[model samples]
Target: MSRLILRCFAVATLLVPVSAFAQFDIEREPINYLKGPVSDPISRLQMRLDEAEVRLTFDLKSGYLESVLKTLNVSETSQMLVFSKTSFQRNRINPRTPRAIYFNDDVYIGWCVNGDVVEVTAVDPQLGGVFYSLDQEEVDRPKFARHTDTCTLCHASSVTQGVPGHLVRSVFPDSVGNPILSTTTYRTTYQSPLKQRWGGWYVSGTHGQQRHMGNMIAKSSREPEAFDVDAGANVTDLSKLINVEPYLAPHSDIVAFLVFEHQAPAHNALTLANYQAKLALRDEEILRKMDKDPDAPRTESIQRRLDHSADLVLKHFLFVEEAPLTDRVQGVSGFAEQFAARGPHDKQGRSLRDFDLQTRIFRYPCSYLIYSAAFDGLPSELKAIVWQKLHNVLTGVDQSSTYQHLSAEDRLAILEILRDTKQNLPASWRK
Candidate 1:
């Protein structure tokens, strides 16, 4: 087994409760239902779906649709099967066009088929339930379907030949169905996309300092050559860099906010609450030093722009918070509650709410800089307006009251800050 798989098993073993071992029961009855052996094509399809669900009960690993034949004492020739939730349509004009289906596990399963579901069945292996098809149903056009090509376009990035599924790298905890830390070339062989971009190893264009490790480790450190903007060395130039857009936008917003709040100059904040103060102070210090030494390593222009970018990010966050929740930006608490009440599968086979919360929450750190920068870079007129609004809300809260008791306007102002910070990021910052 790979190290990642081993690690998962180890973690699972440790976390499994002793009661779980004692509760294991091999004699439990298998769930069963029947559909199909139908003459009509549409009827046959619906029957297939029903049979798949029956088989899935015995192999419940969450969102995985198992084949009835695979779980039963049947030969490979047995026809029972469960189609993946996603499928592709061939472009009539282009036979070479690629198509695929993405499973909940992030595996891509490719196939071509026409028409909607027709029949369904369920079977009980433990009880030996008989197989039969339900009445035929008319095909209805599907309202939503993701193209197979879209699946391959992304999955092609981390596919392993020997592995059954695509390698998905995630920071969340892994369950039986979802592997949190799958093996990937990016981690073991190729440089980690995150590290490569953030560590400043590769400068994008000719506009910045050259301080890569090779120069730092040399006996006589020398500046690396200016980045080739035309060739695209920095992350800004690399479209394939993972999560670059979302990550950078928020990062800039946070920086911007810090610059505005603290009016300090340093990039690093002394305290979380005082981040803005520190950045603003740092900017002032840099400007002062530059006056004394014209050839200083840091340039005033860069510092000013960084501050401006930070301000813009903060403004965007505020805007997002104020906006009503659409398909995106649903609050974490609300989403979790909805997921808890959902049936076996969401509309998309996978639970949309769970996926959104898990993926988006984990990626928050990626955008911290953008958010900071947005705050710092607000236009002078807007800065005064935001600052005053914030001040009034903060002052309005009584010393005796907790944050939960704050008035709606006060809450709205804070939401505005978050929304604006999220929404106003420049096109370059978007994914």
Candidate 2:
């Protein structure tokens, strides 16, 4: 009977589940997934920015600002928060503390305030996201507001009716928004530290008052040539009035909003380009997905193609700095030497010279510089994608042969590819 009981106990032990054997036993401590060094404030700020859904359109990390900061040797201590009434204004006021009073559009009255930042218990009129700082620190306000009267007098005539915001006039066939061309109205009035009439978009003009030289008499409505002055005194050339290109009031309100209000980096041509590229890619992706559905009916393929073409054109504009590889060398011999040094080996263990007699062609350094520079300004996410694309090209894993060849036709093809590729990218890339 004892032997039988022992056999039963052994059977029960063998039948017990593995989980039951470990029952009541303490589990090993979880791996510290969040372990490591604490991140710095700037890194924290970047993470917050990502959380806030701020699309850093340009590569902010290695951008022109970084270069400028390096050249100036301007430390963080040297940075000062300043508010200038106008781009032409020489005086800049410290927003942290105020000594005098200024016009307040909200109350329609000028009052002397102790500081630039005012606590508003009342509801915000715009961007009703609560008038508070993210860091729980005091909210510093710019001296000027976007809805100010001085700003509206000139910008009101803008394409957006004085919105003083980015004028998204029309989406090109490729889905990129072409910035509303600055008209005579914008040039005549609206002054800002940035707003230039030339260089397509994003003010490339020097920040200053426009100097109007004179008017052509032949183009004038009134005949100033026949006008005479007092006895023996010459009449000032009526045809040549020194009319300054209307010092259109600077959109200080917009500038202030971009800089202090949003705490965004200063708007530049590069930023504008990045914004356009993102928009274009978005449009292309939507169209491509729509085209793929056979059940959706044979809808506007022509329109889609047109849009694709337009995107290609815009990409060309964005990549205008990339020169053709062929243009780099004076002759074929110099090109060959450079090509041999770069080593374009094929899968068949053959060099570029073995496959093509014209292996002497050199790659354009300027093109590489432009491509690399563009990647530098992109946000971290997009920068990673750009880096990946570049890596593929360098490894010959990607068909960037058209871009490498440097022919006009190849350039256009590469532009199209770039547009399509950008469109297919995830939305996270833009952010």
Return the TM-score for each candidate structure.
0.18, 0.23
How well is each residue in 1-431 modelled by candidate 2, as lDDT tens digits?
A: 67557545544543443223221111111111112122222233335555763322212222222222232232221121112121112122222111111111111111111222221111111111011111211222212122323322332223322222222111101102112223221221111211211111111111123211111111111332221112111112211222212111111111111112111111112232333334334443544454554344322432332333333322332233232122111211122233233333333332322212122212221122122223344434334444444434433455543334345443443333333333343343333
Which regions of candidate 1 are displaced past 4 Å? 1-299, 320-431
| CA deviation > 4 Å runs, candidate 2 | 1-298, 305-431
lDDT of 2 at 234: 19
Error of 1 at 154 (Å): 11
The CA lDDT of each predicted structure is 0.25, 0.24
- Summed over model 1, clashes come to 110
